[model samples]
Target: MKKVLITGGAGFIGSNLALKLIEKGYEVTILDNMSKQIHGEDYTKSNLYRNIEGKVKFILGSVENKEDWRKALKNIEIVVHLAAETGTGQSMYEINKYIDVNIKGTSELLDILTNEIHSIKKIVVASSRAIYGEGEYICPNHGLVYPEEREDKYMSCGDFSVKCPICDVTVKLKATTEETKKHPSSVYGFTKQAQEEMCMIVGKSLNLPVVAFRYQNVYGPGQSLKNPYTGILSIFSTRIKNNNNINIFEDGQESRDFIYIDDVVEATILGIEKNEANYQTFNVGTGVAITVQEVAEILKEKYNSNVKIEISGNYRLGDIRHNYADLTKIKKLLGFQPKINFNTGISRFVKWVETQNIENDNYEKSIEEMRQKGLYK
Candidate 1:
């Protein structure tokens, strides 16, 4: 069996991929810090590593620590870097934390790769769709345009449309192509873009195969129900389950390209197995865009909860209006297609969520933290 090292192996997507690789006859080793934001205060409480007990080697450490990387990369043939602080809004305030973990941590890993005599031949990384910023759009007068971030003045007036840069008219949001220019509106997105670029640059010099998967909003079973900063589906599910009011940010029309966890895992697996995905970046997401209101309604109907859904006119800094993926590259090259629709995926997600303890949501508190930092408006 081929030996693989997954950096954030105990994370939402990493944990799932670890299990899938194990099933496919690959020996896996994980190096994770198990950040409290995602895994809670107790690292031992994580279900991600617990399920794969004795089946894989688990190193409880951070990628920022060179010692941890050294220990984790022992005899590993493949590397999947997934350990990073992942909160767009929170990243705005916690600037140092995001940079240290995402950029510096990735730097340390590359340093290790550059100096160390490791058996690693292939590597894959987790990039975010946030890098695309406002993404692609089209105006009737103009042909095709990649929008700039919407102005707060327009947004404050409740005009949420992304306007054409040239025509200055409201443009229709289209699927973000991989070739789109990356002007990340968030610190988190900036760090991810840097990480991907660093990997590609260094990978070429070393002749190592690298795959950067620009993932959209990934949601499914085993997501962190406690983390209010990320994963809107889990946040809504937890709040609705506890009869708490669902606070929808911005206009309810703000949509995202959410991909099922299984599809993400499948794409990652393809990146690992296929040589065609080498030294290339592909966007991994459902091509379809679904509104935030639609997600709220789906969960409300599924749980049959009486909780009020509030579309607060509140907006957050470092947020995009609408962005979805154009999966043409990944589909044509890797033969990948998303099988689960939002309805089926959410149904499965809610079933798994119901089995867990609905923790006390510090939703307002999390928002308060951002508000104090001028991130939440």
Candidate 2:
């Protein structure tokens, strides 16, 4: 059995992937710091690692620590680097934190591979669609264009669509291909772009097998309901559970390509096993775009909660108007396909959310931090 070390292996996605890898007859090891935001203040209290308890080797550590990487990488054949600070809004204020964990952590991993003698030759890291910024759009006159992130001028007036650069007309949001030029609009996005670039560049030079999955908005069970800066599904679920109204940001029409956790794991494992994935970047998404308003409505209907859904007209400064991935590359090369649609996936997710204890609603506090930094408008 091949030995696999998954950094950030205790979080929602990492934990899910670890279990599947173990079942597939691979020796599995998990390395996670269990950050207070994702795993809560007390490590004993977090149920994040409960599902994988006694199933795999667990190391309580951060990826930023070279000592931790050295310890975790022992005899490991494949490394899946999923650990990073994932908050777009929070990242605006916590600039150094993002750089340290996401950017520096990856660099440290590269240093280990280059400097040390290790069995590890393959690395799979989590990248994000946010690196595409507003992504690709098609204007009637201009054909296809990759627009910039929506400005406050248009967002202020509640016009929440990417317009053509030449004509200033509303352009249709198209499926963003892997070839789409990267134009990240946030500090978080910048770090992810840097992480992916560094990995690919270094991996090629060293003849290391590296796969970067540019993941869309991943949602499903085992997500951190306590973390406000998590995916929109978790944020809204926590708010609804507490009988608090959800303030839908920016017309609620701004969209994301929400993919389920299981599908994400499947795509990742396929990349790990396939040789064609060597030093390649693939976009992982359901390839189906869903609006924020639609997501809130589905959750409300399922929960049957009377908690008001307010279209607050509030917009975040570093946010994009719309984005969804073009999964053609993954499908063609890795023979991967998303198994769950948003409707079915969210239904399963809502069931899981109902079973768990309602986490404290820290939504406002997250907003305040961004607002102070002038990132939240």
Candidate 3:
């Protein structure tokens, strides 16, 4: 059995991936700090923590610590780095924390591998679609173009469409490929971009195989419902369950490519098992863009809730207007394709949410934090 070390292996994706790896007969070990934000205050008793507890070797430590990386890498043949501070809005105010954990922590792991002899054969780091920012858009006049961050002046007036950089006219949203120019709009995105580039650059120098998976908006069962900063699906469900009104940002037309958790897990597995994935970055998404309005409506219908779906003109500074992955590369190389469509995946997720203890809605608190920072308007 191949021994694999998964950093942040106790969280949603990490816990699920760890379970899958164990089922496939791989010896798994997890290193995680178990943040209260994701796991709640009684973290040891949380389902995410309990699910993997005693199932694998668990090390409670921070990836920011070199000693933690040193201890976790022992006898490991593969390393799946999933540890990082997420939430784009929070990252804007908590800039130092995001950079320290995402970029500096990743550099620490690479430093250890560069200096010390380890049994590691493969490394898989989680990148985000946020690195693509506004992504690619086609202009009638300018052809293909990457738009800059939308100005607050325009967004303040309810104009949310991304425009052509050259002509300043509205552009069409195109699937963002791995080759898309990365000009991240948020601090979280900037750190992820740095992390991916650094790993690829250092991996080539070390002659070591490294694979970066640029995961789209991943959602499904086992995701953190308590966290209000990320995962809109979870956030909406919690509010609906609490009989609170659902708030949709922008005009409710702003969209994202939501990929199911199982599909994301399968893609990561392919990246780990396939030699074609070596020294490359693959976008892990279903390639279907779903609007925020649609998501809110679906969740409300599925849950049989009477809560109002408010289309708030509220906008976040670093939020993207639209972005979806182009999966041609991963499909051709790894024979990987998403099996779970949005409808089916959302149904399964709602069922799972019904069975769990409904978490208290802290959505407003998180938004208030951003509002105080002047990031949320």
Candidate 4:
């Protein structure tokens, strides 16, 4: 069987990807520190764990430690680096913590793989859309702009503009292509940008096959709903399931390109399978932007519960007004397309949450109290 090493394999996306690979008959090895509770319990007990529980090897350790990485990389044919301190607002306060895990950890992992692991040929590192801070303004004809708002909604000043709506303001909202100029807004984004640059420079210098994926909002089951700094869908779902009001920051108009977990896993596997994926950075998203209000409505309809929603006028600092991926390059290069729609995916998530008896528990209460205490502050 083809052996693959997946860092953060116990986390939401990593665990899902590991299961998908196992289903495809690949031998999987998971490396995780178990520092945080992923989903609800240890990664070993996550919803997807049953799929690969005994079949895969689990290494408990941190990526920042070369000894741990060395043990994890043995006989590894491919490495999928997904481990990172992935919080935007939280990173603002914990800058060094983010740097330790994302920058230093990734650097250490790469150094070991390049110098020590001889069998590993390709690596797929997780990058983020955050690298393109706010994005640039372009004319409706896809021409560059000089500080003015672009015409395309996808490329515009609006939260979710894709193309120019008017003839005169025919500029496209600056959609982030692989070549788009990077200006990360948060410390998390800056670290991710650094991660990509490191891969580019080191991979080129060492002649290693490296691919970086700039992911949009990834959500689904097997995510830590208890963590405010994690996936929004899981967080909202947990709150609503426990009969707590959902809080919406900055009105309900802020839009995001939310990709289902399954689609992301599929794209990741494709990135590893295709030779063209090497030395490239591709955006992985549905290329469809949906507002936060739309997501709440969808969840409401799916759960058949009249969950109360509280809209706070305050917005998180460094939060982008709008974010969606341009799929032109991903489609052209990897023949990748998001198959699941927002409503369909949300329905599935609702069904899963309904089965978990998450009402009035300590975890639920603590989250509610935290929100009440303004822990998000």
Question: Over the stretch 1-377, how does candidate 1's per-residue lDDT look in tens digits?
Answer: 99999998898998899999999999999888888878888867767657666777989898889998899988999999998889888899889999999999999989989997989899899999999999888889987888888888888888878889897899987888889999999999999999999999999999999999999999999998888889999889879977899988888999999999999999999999999999999999999999999999989989989899999888997899998999999999999999999889999999998899878787788899998987777
> Model 2, stretches more than 4 Å misplaced?
none
lDDT of each: 0.91, 0.91, 0.94, 0.76
Q: State which candidate has the highest TM-score.
A: 3
lDDT of 2 by residue, 51-98 (tens): 888898999988889999999999999999999999988888889999
Q: For this target, which candidate reaches the highest lDDT against the unseen true structure?
A: 3
Task: In candidate 1, list every pair of residues with a backbone clash.
Answer: none
Candidate number that wins on lDDT, 2 or 4: 2
- In the order shown, the candidates' Cα RMSDs to the true structure are 1.0, 1.1, 0.7, 5.1
Residue 88, model 2: lDDT of 88
For candidate 4, write residues 138-236 as lDDT tens digits.
664646642222223332233333223234443344555767678776789999999988988888888888999999999876666556665777767
lDDT of 4 at 28: 93
Q: Could you tell me the lDDT of residue 125 within candidate 2?
A: 88
After superposition, candidate 3 runs with Cα above 4 Å error: none
Is candidate 2 or 4 superior in TM-score? 2
